[model samples]
Target: MSTACPSNPRKRDRESSPAEQWRNLARTVPATLMHIGTSSSVKAIRSTKNAKSAMKAAKRSGDLSPAGKPDASGSSWPPEAVELLQQARDDVSIGLKALRDTRDAIVVEFFDAWKVLNQNR
Candidate 1:
């Protein structure tokens, strides 16, 4: 068996410096936040649609047996599902608010740092 060494040394690209990485992260964080906003919007819409459909179905069935109430078992609608849906909405709201706040803070910090750097020059 013979061991062979490669003749050429590969050089890695150094385009991604720390500053560049931070810049990329700053850009990506906002995009990620936007994505989260969109996803939450979609989920909210879907949940609303599902809730409406369930209500319509119940209305159509005319099942007044009280036991026929879709939410009687607390499995799908009456209390648990409603509470869950509300919680989901609240969670998304809080998350978006937090992301927005974080993004604003990052932006302010970046600008302040930039000002300091320029002043030092």
Candidate 2:
């Protein structure tokens, strides 16, 4: 992250600027937690916000829900939050694979049609 956002040192550097020890408490805590056994990252905040905004827009346009209600019944889903999260992840994985397969099929069909036309000519 530091390498990717070299220009945006938004987080206070804890290791660097050793001279700041005198006013360590005065400085805000650095957000470089990824290195310290925590995969929690600052970049995920932006991604979460972006996804929320996109879903909000989709909902408003009636794309996500025409009735503006929950898509599924809670009874059908797992009661535990962890299980629900895993189910959602699996849904996304399956959707992505299906979309990729559809795109590949379309491309193959187009290429095959072009090849047959050339052969006939």
Candidate 3:
């Protein structure tokens, strides 16, 4: 004779598997990157105050060398940082395009539905 308990087995106590963890992280990274990019862009724009103010500051502080040149003496911001900023800008642009497309599609769908309903009536 064989005996088996009817109760369900206890939930497995385990961390996510490596692949699962990686997938989860991958999903989160884009959102985090987008947030960081948007924040940096906002900061950059805000820091400029007005274009005139920024130009004046740069000119007065000698950040711009003679003849309105950017000085090479300062450390270059990391290439990765610049790349990320560009990616963020592109992502935002794509997102806006997607939103517009979706809105247009929905409007068309709604109008089509209304036409169908009117025809049926």
Better of 1 and 3 by lDDT: 1
Best-to-worst lDDT order: 1, 3, 2
Question: How does each model score on lDDT?
Answer: 0.55, 0.42, 0.50
Q: Write the per-residue lDDT of candidate 1 for residues 9-110, one digit (tens) a residue.
A: 465334545556558667766676566566655665565565555555544443443466555454544454456455555655655665566557667756
Score every model by TM-score: 0.38, 0.35, 0.37
Error of 2 at 89 (Å): 0.1
- lDDT value, candidate 2, whole model: 0.42
| Model 3 stretches with alpha carbons more than 4 Å out | 1-75
Residue 2 displacement (Å), model 3: 63
lDDT of 3 by residue, 30-86 (tens): 565566556555645544344334345444544333445433543343344344444
Q: Could you tell me which residue pairs clash in candidate 2?
A: none
**Winner of 1 and 2 under lDDT:** 1
lDDT of 2 by residue, 1-121 (tens): 1123467679564453323432442332222212321222223334454445544553444433334543455333223433434444554555455455545655665565456445534
Model 3 scores worst on lDDT over the 10 consecutive residues at 74-83
Residue ranges of candidate 2 with Cα displaced over 4 Å:
1-79
Clashing pairs in model 1?
71-78
